[model samples]
Target chain A: MQENKHIIELKYLSKYYKGSNVPAIDNINLNIDKGEIYGLLGPNGAGKTTTISILCGLFGPTSGNVFIDGMEFQHSAEKIKSIIGVVPQEIALYPSLTAKENLTFFGHLYGLKGKHLKTRIDECLELFGLEKNANRRIKTFSGGMKRRINLIAGILHKPKIIYLDEPTVGIDVQSRKVILEHLKNINKEGTTIIYTSHYMEEAENFCSRVAIIDKGKILTEGKPKELITAKGEYTDLESIFLNITGRALRDE
Target chain B: MLRLLSSIYKELLVLIRDRAGLAILFIMPLVLILIMTVIQDATFRTVKEVNISMILVNNDKDSLGEAISEGLYASDFFQIVEEINGEKITEENAKELVARGDYKIGIIIPERATEAIRGNVNALINKSFKSFNIPGVKKRTKKSTIDITIYIDPATSNSFKNMVMSSLKEFTSQLEIEMFFKNFSEAMAQLMPDQKPIKFDSFETIRYKEVYASTTENEILPNSVQHNVPAWTMFAMFFIVLPLAGNIIKERDDGSAFRLKTMPGSFVTVMFSKIFVFLGVSFVQFILMLLVGVYIMPALGLPQLEIGPHKIALAVMALSSGLAATGYGVAIGTIATTHEQAATFGAVSIIIFAALGGIWVPVYVMPHTIRIISQFSPLHWGLNGFYDIFLRGGDLMVVLAEAGKLLTFFVIMLGVAIVYNNYNKTK
Candidate 1:
């Protein structure tokens, strides 16, 4: 484990998917120190997920090594995984499993058990206003309800670092506020937060620093206000990102 | 009636939407029956195959030994494994073959089996002499007799012995009638001392090697419903792979799989849990299907699915079959990239196996090549097991052989699923 302020380091990471003509991510090097809420701001298909997946050891980069808290994924994947939580962009839950069952399962996955695990699940469910619906299957949940449970699922073990890929996407304003607030509360409690979103206003107010990526390349990386200053006249990240990466559709 | 028709209409709609489910619900069973019916008429005639294979020990080289050997060999209910038969098979070898489970039954025609024939003939001659009532006629008779020993493997169903004995009894009666006619011919010669001998040995019994395992001479009626019910039950059980694969693919495509990766358990743990769940589902499926087969079918005027004297054998069948189906389900479910892909692959593979395994057509009706292919199907082993207990009245050991096959399939498929999951994770 690294005894330094920076808890994560991505060194020259690139991912070329099998049979694909182009790499999903290309030569990306980045670092996020402890006690910072970082965001990867990008349009869809802009390699934001590719970067987070590598960071969480979901898949290995074809041409790079990742070090989480100075532990290389190749050597200490389990140890790294213990301290990192991942919230995937999709609502990743068993529709057949109740909220309590899902939480208990994921909690045990992170090595929680017994009354302590039960207590933690109750706490998480209560915090997300889902204590009443604990026994209801996740499939019956609305998009926002599922999103809240999804966030709670990732953070069950109180990992030192949590990565969320579009955690607030496609949810009601109330759900988005609760999720964003909870993410902030965890960051205050010393969890390093890395989130990605195309919503400029959310990233501007939320992340301490943000990297805007396009076509597998990072066009700019800085504290949001500083990036805005560099653009000379743009008031918010939307104008800055649009100006730097263009407004044409990037779907392919 | 309107509601019933509409319900069927709704079901059809659901099936159409589910390409995999539709194939299983209609295509597999229909294809199985069609293929078997076609094979049933084509050069493969209709002699029912006996599930029992016998190891014959004929030590007597006389006419009596040939009669015993040929009688069983010709019977539709018995398969005399010729490669292992002949005078070379000693009592010890026969016992060992049965004990080692290479064969379920062993029959020994003792070294002096000719005495059985001679004794009967002599008795007839003496009776003829007494009936003449001549002044100096003597009443002398042969007192020798040979015991035919049938060694049955207790591990198998007692029904096998019954079948063999049934055939043997028929053989004895026929032998007695022939000897009586031959003696009558001889008596005529003794009385007249002028006629050439009348041959009494021109009997031609039914031959059924072409139809394979002909049981016609034995008059062993097959419980067709028992065969059909368990067969389609297995076909349905293995089709558990469809929903299993669908669930896995759904999890994968929807991100639950990725969440699981970030969670603490190894991929093997996740796969095993799915298998365990499916095993439970399969067990329930077996019980309900069999309930319908045994009680409901008979109530509805169909042949009862006979459990015979081996209810534990049925339990073992259910347990092993459940695991086998679940293992198959877990394997394909994890390997397929999409739910439809998994469903298609699992359904098609199971249907092909069901057809080849004699689920619709009896294995006897298949072409020789297809019969050989059927052995490779786990469904074949399962069907053979059901037939053992139902038709052949086989015992525990008989069912164990089939259960062992299903268990082996479970182990192999589970191993593959685990390996494939880990491989995918690593890559």
Candidate 2:
């Protein structure tokens, strides 16, 4: 295993969905170093999810290659799966299960068992201020409570690299703050985060570095402040994104 | 390990927490069971009693004709109608009436029937032994055979025909034997020179045993109810599980499956856990309804059954077959894109399985090729298992081979489900 260094590397990774001429993700290269929050900032359909999904090894890229800590996804799928946690854009959680039960089940999938699984669940619940609601069914929970639990579900296994796809998509400010803060703290404790979102302001404030992509291709990449300065009078990351992606409702 | 167990625990918690869904899963099945049992019970009671309507035609104007008619009416075997048979009974008219299904049997006595019996009995014996040897004397002593035509409706059941035939034969044979004995005695007295004349007035002997009579008439009904009820119950139990299994697939499509996946267990473990839960639900529903049938319903005057060892064993085997059904549900759900599709597939599969399994009708009644096709469904095994227990008194071990076949079906379906989920994930 390639240890204690670069967590993710993507080179010439592209995906053309079946029966589609246009590719969802274009050939691009990037390296995600350890213990940093990297954001893939893009408009809808800008290959933001495609990139994160590739890193998670959900499916092989149509062409090109992805390596997690020097191991190819095709050859080291199980190993890669064990190390990386994916929090999808959709709230992927069992609504019928209580928070604790849901956590326990996911923990078991990662081969966790007994007291260790219970302790992890308890700790996550407490950290997210969800300890009191651990026994409450997820269907009874609010959207914010469910989002918090969703984040916690991925982190329970203590994966080295965690992928968050629009984690704060539809939550209230307070929930979003709590989730982002928890993610920041988790990253501080030796985890690499690759986040994707259309929230340019949040990406500017929370991410150490960001890439603005559109039409399945990256237009720019740098620290938000540096990029602002590089493009004269840009003033903010939103301006940079608007200048690059244009004003179009991405419905079709 | 612990994480996998926790995942299973969580899935079950979620599964149970949906109170409406849980209620439907538990209550709906029992309601259906109750309905099916009630219908079958009614059917069983209706098919057991045997009552046949008959037309009696008597042309004999003597006491012997009256006695024959009285004997048939006296027995509880037939319902005798007078208007259907006119004074003159013909073979053609009797056949036409019997074919209309209004009557089970028709009786026709020739015009000379009474005259023939009376002529032989009243004839005075010749006074000479020399005259007894004459051909004319022998011809005069000979008895005529009465033409009593008993027309049986071919459309009537085999058992009903047998009862009618046996009763008629007994009545006619007794009459003939009495006539022959009377004629022989008269002839012997006429030839005896030193014998006192025998008084035949007090010599009447009723040929058949007559039982103690009551005013109450025994009522008979059809026998289809009993055969159809138990047969349908087994079929309903075997086929109902398929639709419930579709609900399992609906949860997966709703994103609950992915949520469970991210938690800590193998999808296989969660799957097996659901199977266990569903199978338990189905089996419990089965036993509860049957208990109601055997115990509580009897208090209300319903026919209750005793739980024999064979019945218990067959119940256990039936449960295993239900598990196989759940497996098929899980597999189908995993492959379907939506709950509606899952439900449709469940319905379609159950119908096909029921048809093949001999639930809609018995395999014996089906053509040979269709019977062979029914062998592929898990329903067939389940229904067969029920038959072994409730009807045929078969035990668990006796149904093991069939149960094994169902278990194989369960395993294959489970494997397919696993492959489907994994493929979807990768795709």
Candidate 3:
């Protein structure tokens, strides 16, 4: 039943760091279909970033195999990487480079070049309202502006799959709205996205499906409303997340 | 390949826009060459006072010849080249030795030089007393004169020539006084018992009949500009570590390197791009510094730096030195965690290396221990390569060891950098 429907599959995924008894991510198994906005929701230290990082092949899981588009990460990393993009939680843009230059470099990295990449860059910048400051160095931009440029850098190639680790993190509501709307529009165009967020309300509204995780293990997995109804008498996703992952602050 | 090109292109763009960095790379070296040339070359130093080697051929074998030979052998200034055959060196052979190149000055003493000087003194005594009709002095007088021949290669420096000629005046003056005193002592003995009277040492007896046999190749001698140009240029090339390391550390801290990892290419591609960009920058630096040394220094009233006969050797040595410096830059980039850490660590360590390698001073001036110490420095290898071609007129084969050593150092350092980077970074 899962064949041909799921684009990403993780089998018994586990990651145990050196000198630590507990695993960072333990015995995880999941499958997400293509063209769906799948969210990995958790509090801090919930392994949301770690799962996304591994999915992007940032590092290997201690004991597991990840298959994306029917190609294993270990065997076909180059192919899988070419079709995927990652927007990390940290601002990954070069401060010395202008927004346009940064985008152009990322485009060339993904084998996009010539006038085609240029036109695509212009369209993306215009859509994000960053065309006005395309030539300004990222160091001169505001926090919100830098975040938007960072987002633009990841999508420059228009990858088939994008993994965003908190795309709207630490920005004003205006910048947040612009970023979320663009993401939704891209998703509507049939690109699969794996999004990790601590914002329960946003994930409930945005994700077609989500897995609530805690202590490196998934507690529940389903549609937000279904999971909300199933877990006790919680009326909303945020209360359900709190009741599941607990009110205690988890730090890595 | 296109990704590599784009990455290198971006690195070049960033480097070009760094005005302060470019100024340090270009202007500091050129300006330092000028300043050092003015200070190190302005003072006049004697050739013999600074360890000059010459061939000495003495057929006199007398006290005079012995005195001159001993002077050279004992003085720290002159280094005498002893003939291996033990045969008395002829004037012709001495000139040939000087002409062959490394030795610029040759000394040859003719036979009977002391006898000729003694005879001339007696004749002068007889003539002085001719007006008084001194019979015995006139009867004992013999007429002869000493002629000291100096065969020098015309290519010898004016200062060395002057130094050689200045010694001639001293020989003549000292001999003349001895001859005069000897004649007077003998004249006084005629009035006494003739029992080996109170006579001073004879001037003609201890006098040296020596002159430059001829000049040889003076091209190998290093002047101010030749010395300062290469030393300061290589020193400046290594300073690239500052900007290079700063770029690396900044990218790592700002998360650009991590982003690059998740992009299209492998880790090797990005690393190769950075190293290639640095190599290009170093090459440009080498060319610019050479232009200043070979062309600009002369226009500014300084001695023009020589590229010697083999221009290809110069080019090869320059490339090797640049690559070695860049390799060091790569290694420093990996080890340093912060910009300040990278900059200061590289700066201080290189400065120490330069100091210990005799870059700031001529290796000849270094003591035996320091000379041994200098052999371990990569800067010393590069400086030796430059010196071989610039000062020693060494061919490619002659300079191959220095260049090879530098290239080997480049390989080792580059290997360490790559492995260290691979270890720190996730695959």
Q: lDDT: which candidate is best?
A: 3
DockQ of each: 0.21, 0.33, 0.45
Candidate 1 docking class: incorrect
Q: What is the lDDT of candidate 1?
A: 0.76
Query: Over the stretch B37-136, how does candidate 3's per-residue lDDT look in tens digits?
Result: 6666554234524667777877777755666677668776667875748775678787777777757788776787666666677777767666677643
lDDT of 3 by residue, A126-177 (tens): 9999999999998899999998989888888988899988988889999999
lDDT of each candidate versus the true structure: 0.76, 0.70, 0.80
Show what share of the native A-B interface contacts model 3 retains: 0.63
- TM, every model: 0.67, 0.74, 0.73
Residue-level lDDT tens digits of model 1 in B141-166? 46566788887887865545666788
- Worst 10-residue lDDT window for candidate 3 chain A reads A1-10
- Candidate 1 vs 2: which has more TM-score: 2
For model 2 chain B, where is the 10-residue window of minimal lDDT?
Answer: B214-223
